[model samples]
Target: MKHTMLAVLLAVVMAPGLALAHSEARPGAPADGETLSAPPEVVRLNFGGPMRITVLKLVGPAGEVPLARTDGMQPVTTLEARPEGELGAGAYEIEWRGMGADGHIMEGTVDFQIEP
Candidate 1:
């Protein structure tokens, strides 16, 4: 009973720290729900922790747009991406998959719009 109680206490104490380890994108460029009169030349994803992006894509009104990954893609705090062509006025979504510093695979999406 004593051993079991100790284990439970440890688990409770560690849970919050484990939860904070999950990487999350915060304050992204072309932030969620933002509307712009002109398209942004580049998109920036800022994370709360270090991460390595493996896949990044952009889906626009016309369809999936070609996204080129820029530098700063290592296990840094940010990842940069740019579209191959100019984006017309419309809604767009940026999807990304990556490995967190904790060795966990994580994915996220950001949605925004280009105003007409």
Candidate 2:
């Protein structure tokens, strides 16, 4: 019983730290699994804390698409990018990798569809 009690105490003490360690940035615009009637003007990411985006890619039905970064390659709480050209109707995915405020490498993807 004493061992079990200690284990419980450790879990309670470590829970918040573990949660923060696993925290990740989330898509702010053109949200994950979203379907839109038209293309979004910009792609945005919202981070729980400041993060330096290392790589950002936009993939469409045809192939890889190009983007113009508004946030540059710097640490920011919010990051934005604009597509260089108009997007046609199809599925799209935006993948990103970054160095989180905690100095850990973090990555995520946002999937959305453009309706014809």
Candidate 3:
């Protein structure tokens, strides 16, 4: 009987911690609803798991600018790039594909624009 009691107590303590470990992108990226003026220097992907970014693309005037891995970050979940060059003005679409430590590839986008 004592052993069973101890096992029950142990499980009660560990259950909550396990739940917090797996994080989710709530609502959506660019966080469901967010506004911007000019295209963000870098498209940020914030997630609960450590995600591996596989693709990045920015579509705007002139043509589709492939957003380099270096969008707006040096390290630790940052894209190391900036919106530059002769890219024309207009709303831009930022698309990205990546994987999480959970072994799942999650892709999303956020649209921030440049005014006329």
Q: What is the C-alpha lDDT of each candidate?
A: 0.88, 0.89, 0.59
Cα lDDT tens digits, model 1, 53-73, are 988899998999897876556
Off by over 4 Å in 3: 1-23, 26-40, 71-76
Q: Could you give the candidate ranking by lDDT, starting with the highest?
A: 2, 1, 3
Alpha carbon lDDT at 96, candidate 3: 71
Q: Point out where model 1 deviates above 4 Å.
A: none
Our tally of clashes for model 2 stands at 0
**What is the TM-score of candidate 1?**
0.89
Clashes of each: 0, 0, 8
Q: Give the Cα error of residue 9 in candidate 1, in Å.
A: 1.5
Q: Write the per-residue lDDT of candidate 2 for residues 61-113, one digit (tens) a residue.
A: 88888999977697988998999977999999999998976788998899999
Q: Give the TM-scores of the predictions, in the order they appear.
A: 0.89, 0.81, 0.58
Return the lDDT, model 2, position 52. 91
Residue 107 local lDDT, model 3:
77
Best by TM-score: 1
